[model samples]
Target: MSAQLPKIFITGATGLVGSALVTELLAKGHHLRALVRTSSAQLPGSVEQVVGELGQPVDLSDSQVVIHAAARVHVMQETTSDPLVEFRAVNVDATLALARQAIAAGVRRFVYISSIKVNGEGTEQGKPFKTNDVPAPADPYGISKMEAEQGLMALAKESDMEVVIIRPVLVYGPGVKANFRSMMNWLNKGIPLPLGRIDNKRSLVALDNLVDLIVTCAQHPAAANQTFLVSDGEDLSTTELLTRMSKALDRPARLLPVPAGLLELSGKLLGKDAVMQRLCGSLQVDISHTRDTLGWVPPVSVDSALRKTADHFLSTL
Candidate 1:
């Protein structure tokens, strides 16, 4: 360990990624300052909390690195009015505002947690997305993230700070919600799901793996001014994922051969085509650049991570 650990400031410390990152950084002996809204709860022992909204200016004094992980992540309904405005307030405006503060405070590194949607929705013919590909953000959330990255890169060019952007795909683990929890619920009930026939590769990152990469980027010299796409490096089809979940839970896999198109249509009628798209869409990420450049590999394998997820779910039952 370095004699003097870097003073790190993080946003979204209560969020899935931010909380995990806080744990990882604490283990590495880094000094942390976390920003939180007035309504946010205090984190575990001794973390310095500076109460402020994401839209407000951050005080980055004594901070050497800033990890901007806060964002509005929910996919809004099609009828959502001014979705972009809401997303921009946190994702773009606040992110840049914090970055500017970090630069002024003499922070050397800024790590931004972006999303894979910046690359695009789905891959071409099962081919994974690379880091250098042009950004094709589909939704307001994705567009906001993309614009934030551009703004951060421009800020880096003008300031002394080194900016490293990471795009993580489908992160899941303990305390996960929405689709991940729903999947676990289906498995727990031993329900026969009609997802056995759909063969689509979905790339995912374990919470630990994503945190490890972020910590590495925070310190690694090669990570400066680079954009990287990260994942577990093992793509799994929906059936394969369900099968593994079953094995992890020590339950029999119950799968039916329902037509993929029919399922998609049903989801559409229910205004849940996005959910179906996530389960059945092919969204692979090529992380060779991160590995080759930073010599970083995901510390946990897909099987082990999946098993951990299952174990967590089982323990909760």
Candidate 2:
């Protein structure tokens, strides 16, 4: 007979990562509980819903593990008077509060889904971000994640509950939104974008690949109290990425050969220098440690993942 899977309590069950994780965990026969704001929130039939927000008291008494996937994600536009404070209210303070509750409830493991921004905004060419590097967060969102990581590490040292942190690069999949989806729309509409001739490598994790790693960290004995960086094990240039995306969407890519320098200048004048940097800059991550440490590998290939994403995008149209 097979052994029973550990009971898991999860946050952000309605978000991209959380929803996918919920499906994956349930498939593996793990009993699941989710924190939701409303009882009407849609989730899998097997998940037990607990209504509450972060920073509020929660009861994880029956759970053996906790996977914290919710966070105050990056804000492209600074709308708040104090963005850091707003981020900390949910990302750091609420995360720590949940950890304390998990500890008190005898939860054995806590898997945190962090971002690659905690490493830095960009990496030097050919010098990928590694697992052990001094964090240099450039924005308030990254800062809050780093602070939460630090707090969790301190808490782990004083408690029996193991803490596992996994920092993932840009995640794209069926339900992806924001810039990735916009790019797909531009390609599908045959928009002439001046993004060709740019040479920059970027690391991205597919939603499925990231979810696989998260589940691995949740149960792997070696994953206890360790931090990991994950990716699709393939790096692609901006031009290559666009080209692949075009192929996946079965659309023609009208990429003009615009120089990167000119694009940067235009972006600077328009107060979008940060946006241009992402297009023209490289941010690679070395996942050797993640591979060696836990014997983990991204189960999905980039092309396959992109094809899936494109299929979803087309289905929604």
Candidate 3:
């Protein structure tokens, strides 16, 4: 007999990840209940909409799987005086609340979308982050996710609901925001960058690949009670990424091979060390566990995904 399509409840349905997730699942004939803040967002007619934030109660009693993609993502120069407190309200406290409710609703699986930052800031060239590594969250965002993971684990121990955590590295695709979009804009606009000399390996995941894994986990028996890290499984240096982006944009990559040390110093003096560190550092993930355990591979190649991202970027402008 063929496998049955599960009824999935999703949060953050308007954001990039959630939106794409909705589309992917529906394309495979799964029933989706998307929780959004507005009804005006463009979505297929078949998708059931629960218009509200995570605070309000939506019926998940019949949902086979609950995919929590909503969170307090990292914001640059947040104006809130108590950013941590504000972040906790969403990432930590709100997450646990929803998880507890899902458990009460008898949801079969709760897949929490976590960040790779829970592992650490970055990795050395040869030392990629593994799923078993002790969490060393550096920023407020990472710390909150780590706390949420702990809370969910404790809750899972007391309930029949299976909790699966997936910590994905930087996710990029059409309509990407923040840092990835910034890089796309810079390269698309023909801005000369100083990251040519940096020798680093960073792991990034395409949206399609991440969504594929999430769907696999939604039904895979082995994925239950497992915490895994996911990526494109292809690491690229800053220069290489820029070159690829330029190729996608059909533009010349005018790279200045300035010393990485000098660039970092300038960033520090200008209060942008975090930005420089991301460009000049290595952050790789070891996805062997996920691949071996699930018998899965990234569905999209890096080149094709990047090209699609660039095309979408150009269309947006």
Candidate 4:
């Protein structure tokens, strides 16, 4: 890195991934401008805030880097009649618009934060999804992400701007919400869960580790025009995850020894089959390419990250 780091313009400043990213970049002496739809938190007064939504165009002339972390993320229960159309408007159309604007502003690089679902829902045991494999997006949200990647690649081919795409699996850390947070809450409350018997391997990226990768790709010459799968490089089964989480929370894991098959059956009966699959599914990523190609290693250990997340969750109570 140069003594004079490049200015970075990032979207999703309030999100789980983006806020931490802003902090990391700032700590390394980089000036940052963040897009804030609402009053985004965790930023110091020195950082500039660009009040806007994803669909609007922004001035990226002074920025050498653009991190497009904002997107219409996956909705479990989509209310729209045509969800794909809604997803494309922001994820595909608006994202492409932003990339073109960045290119026009002579921004050197664009870092797109994509989802692992673009590679597919889950993989069979011992078979992890690689960045080189063909995409098999299983849902509207994943499909939209693939489309955005394709469009960005096309745009990059016709312009001087470099594009780096990152597809990450479940990202968990302090202040995480949704499923991972719910799991921590359940464990903290000693609520018994029927996931003790399920053996599933899932790759998770710590928030700090992912921020490191984002900053790495922001300027790394080797990372130009590359797509990578990111993880902590440590895979854990459902049972193991619960156990470690319990240890971090200083609570007992009240997981029952229920058969995976029986859990799946009950999930279908209760309209939670998808949730069950997520909790007991195998969704691992092979990050050897990331390590060999980018010379990047996750900066945070999974156990330590989990402990930090547990500490935060406990603090909220």
Maximum-TM-score candidate: 2
Writing each residue's lDDT as its tens digit, candidate 3 over 223-288 gives 988998999999999999999989989999989999989988999999998888899999999999
Poorest stretch of ten by lDDT in candidate 2: 1-10
Quote each prediction's TM-score.
0.95, 0.98, 0.96, 0.97
Where model 3 places Cα greater than 4 Å from the true spot, the runs are 1-3
Report residue 155 deviation for candidate 4 (angstroms): 0.6
Tens digit of lDDT per residue, candidate 4, span 1-317? 64579999999877899889878888899988988876555678878988877768777879999999999998877899999999999999999999999998999999999999899999998999999999999999999999999999999999999999999889998889998998888898899988899899999999988989999999889999999999999999999999999999999989999999998999999999888888888999999988998999999999999999999899999
Residue-wise C-alpha lDDT for candidate 2, range 1-317, written one tens digit per residue: 11468899999988999989998988888898999888844797778999999879998988999999999898877799999999999999999999999999999999999889899999988999999999999999999999999999999999999999999999999999999999999999999999998899999999999999999999999999999999999999899999999999999889999999999999999999889999999999999999999999899999999999999999999
Query: What lDDT does the true structure give each of the candidates?
Result: 0.88, 0.94, 0.90, 0.91
Model 2 clashing residue pairs (backbone)? none
lDDT of 2 at 131: 91
Candidate 1 lDDT tens digits, 1-317: 65588888988899888888888888778888898886456476757888888867778888888888889885735556888998898899988888887888899999999999899899854689999998999988899999999999999999899999999999998778888888888988999999988888889999989999999999899999999999998898888999998888788889998878888899999999888897777899899999999999999998888888888888888
What's the candidate order when arranged by decreasing lDDT?
2, 4, 3, 1
Q: Estimate the Cα RMSD of every predicted model relative to the unseen true structure.
A: 1.7, 1.0, 1.4, 1.3
Name model 1 segments beyond 4 Å from true: 39-42, 76-80, 268-271
What is the clash count for each candidate, in the order shown?
0, 0, 0, 0
lDDT for 262 (candidate 2) = 95
TM-score of model 3 (CA atoms): 0.96
CA error at residue 172 for candidate 4, angstroms: 0.5
